[model samples]
Target: MEQRSVGDIEGPWIEPEFDSNLIRRCRENWAVSIGQVANGVLATFIRQRVGLSIVVPEAKCRIEARYDDDSEMYDGELAAALADLS
Candidate 1:
């Protein structure tokens, strides 16, 4: 069986034009929005469990993609569900 790579993107992945800490802080908030985690490391854990071995990071596995498989639509549906709160 072939060990297919998932969500692996090319790197040095960081841009010198950006502040690494600031960028990391911004991305880290993603998990907080879902109440899924408290930090970048926890984001990876939630994403791995949620996506199984199917979805992963562009690097050595940290954080979920902005859009995972069916995630966008799922998010949309979730938004619709929450729209009632408006």
Candidate 2:
């Protein structure tokens, strides 16, 4: 697969100047979300033998929330989920 930065994908829509800080923050949040989803899938697999069909919708919801500019909600959900895991 070809590699692409978040800025390359989102830069066009961003008004005026490209914000490197926004790109960096987006990249960081994306990674964190992916990691959380991966961990959830692994745990479900080990415990219930469930697969991606179960996890993908949940991930989609989270991603949609982030794209909807509701990242504070996403972050709170993520933090609460992590707290549950701990």
- 1-86 per-residue lDDT for model 2 (tens digits): 11232234333323435666544444343323333433333233223322333333454464446533343433444334433443
Give lDDT tens digits, candidate 1, residues 1-86. Answer: 11322222121323346676545643443223223322332234333343223222222121222333343233343333223233
Per-residue lDDT, model 2, residue 25, is 43
How do the predictions measure up, each by TM-score? 0.19, 0.22
TM for candidate 2 is: 0.22
Worst 10 residues of 1 by lDDT: 2-11
The 10 consecutive residues of candidate 2 with the worst lDDT sum are 1-10
On the 0 to 100 scale, the lDDT of residue 22 in model 2 is: 41
lDDT of every model, 2 decimals: 0.32, 0.37
Q: After superposition, how far is residue 76 of candidate 2 from its true place, in Å?
A: 17
In candidate 1, residue 10 scores what lDDT? 23
